[model samples]
Target: MAGGARASSSSARREVAFRRATEADAYELARRMFLSGERVDMQALATELGISRATLHRWVQTREALLDRVLGDLADEYFTRARRAATGAPDDVIVAVAEGVARATIASGAISGFVRREPELALRLMLRDDASVRRVLVGRLRGVLQDVLPDEAEGLEGFAAATVQLGLLLVWPTLVAGDEPSGERVAEICRALLAGARAGELSGGR
Candidate 1:
């Protein structure tokens, strides 16, 4: 029993380390891109981390999976910054949530760029059932919205999902086609969406 427990604990530690390493490598790659305005290479990242290409390949499984894992870890900071920037009235949570959505759209631009350059990566990040990006986002949003919008919480899931779609759409021109977008445009759209929800025009999941 003692041996088994020790083995399990060791395995758990290794798993944790591997996940952290993946995140680190992914983040460094993103930082390089953010700093130098360059591109990211997964295989090169694996080589830098002293891991077999296949090992890193298995860890990420897909290009966007690796990138998403990197960006997914930034949710906390994103939420806070968005909440601070939010404007408008109505319990504050309304603007707070809208700001969160808008901020997410901006922050995700790089990751979306990866997807735009490689549709395969986008599919991995979004279309898969076990996609870590979506899973992390939904879980984070659920936690934040749970108490703040309890009366409207039941629909938060769909609302969050809608936010994701709208974010992509808002960024599509830039992300998919290298076109720029204004925050005012993004905020305007989000305002309309929130108005719909608050006014009970968007129904069905209620």
Candidate 2:
């Protein structure tokens, strides 16, 4: 009986060791799964890591939290690239960056596929306040706009929020019904909005 108890204890130790998961490890796996157009199944993730669902939960909170991290990482990547690729005056730079983001997102097969596969989840996670991805996106755009138009930074949040909402509306049709990805349409719409914002700023907040 003592020997059996020892063996069980040893097995428990091994399981505990095997189930230890770091936040970075969980995020890397989740992000890769997202980029590959695979469903981010928490059970499968835990299984792949040889860990229990409870362990994954401890490492990354909940499934929604893990997804929020993965989506935020993906958006950051695209937004960074867009900012780097942009060049021009304040208005032009904002427009260029916005256009870059629109094109990159619209062209991503994985994002499109994920949206098509899980429309309801996408809408909730993206448009709702429960997820941080949309807020992170809007915050980043607001930061860029503020940088470009420092004098108008006081009221830029509302404009940035509206821009995010409008962009999502434009892309919803494509995501829901497999409509063609129209980068030009997004660019024009954003161009008009940004230009109008600039013009408003110049015209005493009209």
Candidate 3:
């Protein structure tokens, strides 16, 4: 009985270790796949990771789920860096940040590749209401606008919503029509939205 108990305990420990290792391994590989501008092939990923397809599925559940988490993480990193680098007056800061986002998008081979390879999926994930990627971007951008537009606090939410719409408009061509993203266009649209928001605030919150 004593020997049996020891074996069972050892087995449990090994199982726990395997689960942890699997989680880390899956996340790292998926992130690398995303950064390389390659669509993740589940079977190929499993082979590359030296794990069975069942094991990869067990770790990430579904390919869409994995993509969502990876994209969310990437957006968080980009938005965090942009916010950190932001400076100057509120309007200038937001315009600068928007420009940063545009530049990053235009430069990211991963993003462009993903769009080119999976246009439908990319559009759905980027534009769908329930998508974690869109939610993360909108939430981050909204928080920044809210913090900077103190005078227009009451209308900040509306302003943020509109700003996100503008973003969608600017990026729509790239995601849908496979056109190259334009940083200048992003800057122009964002500047117009900010100016409009500020004007509305000046005009008694209209």
Candidate 4:
């Protein structure tokens, strides 16, 4: 009986894994469609997944919500690559990582295509204060700052938020006016802000 119970438990675990994979497959499918510049239609996704629209809705809530998750995942990937490739002192490393991410984002065909195809929707989704993409980007930067400047815990959140805002502002002209986005410019501004923040911190938060 004990052996049988163990077998049943293993089977149950397998079933759970399968269910999780199904859910992940939904997300992966949606992400792929987005990357391919396809509009993520719930009915189409459900038909492709062989699931009901109700199930898709239950899994991702809404189309905008799913897009938010997809954008967040993409932003996280950019941050990961930037952080991995960064070198130098903590401040310089931070600046480098920001520049790398900004450069990659500006150069991404998928992102640029999405912005060009649906300029208003793309801008609104990305620039909104409550956007998941913005949150993920800011959170990633905050984690890096916390890791590199543990003693500046009191100010890291604000610093990260401000830095991301600055990057967005720089990228705005590219999306709106068809101007070029400069990652080097972002790095320069980030470096200056970091220096100023550190100076203020050292001066007792003045």
Local accuracy by lDDT, each model? 0.55, 0.71, 0.70, 0.76
Of the candidates numbered 2 and 3, which has the greater lDDT value? 2
What is the C-alpha lDDT profile of model 2 across 178-198, one tens digit per residue?
786566776777777766665
What TM-score does prediction 3 earn? Answer: 0.77
Residues 1-206, candidate 1: write the lDDT tens digits: 33453455345434545554554554555444422323457666665455777877776676555566654555445665666665545435544655565556555545555655675565555545565545555565555567566777665445555554555456544555555545566556655765576666655321
Give the lDDT of residue 144 in candidate 3. 81
Q: Per model, how many backbone clashes are there?
A: 0, 0, 0, 0
Error of 3 at 132 (Å): 2.3
Query: Which candidate should be chosen as best, given lDDT against the real structure?
Result: 4
lDDT of 2: 0.71
Query: How would you encode candidate 4's per-residue C-alpha lDDT over 80-118 as one tens digit per residue?
Result: 999999988888889998899899889776677677777
| TM-score between candidate 1 and the true structure | 0.61
Off by over 4 Å in 2: 1-20, 198-206
lDDT-based ranking: 4, 2, 3, 1
Preferred candidate (TM-score higher): 1 or 3: 3
Candidate 1, residue 25: Cα displacement in angstroms equals: 5.4
Per-residue lDDT of model 3, residues 78-137, tens digit only: 778878898999888887777777677667677777888887777777666666766777
Superposition error at 7 for model 2 (Å): 37
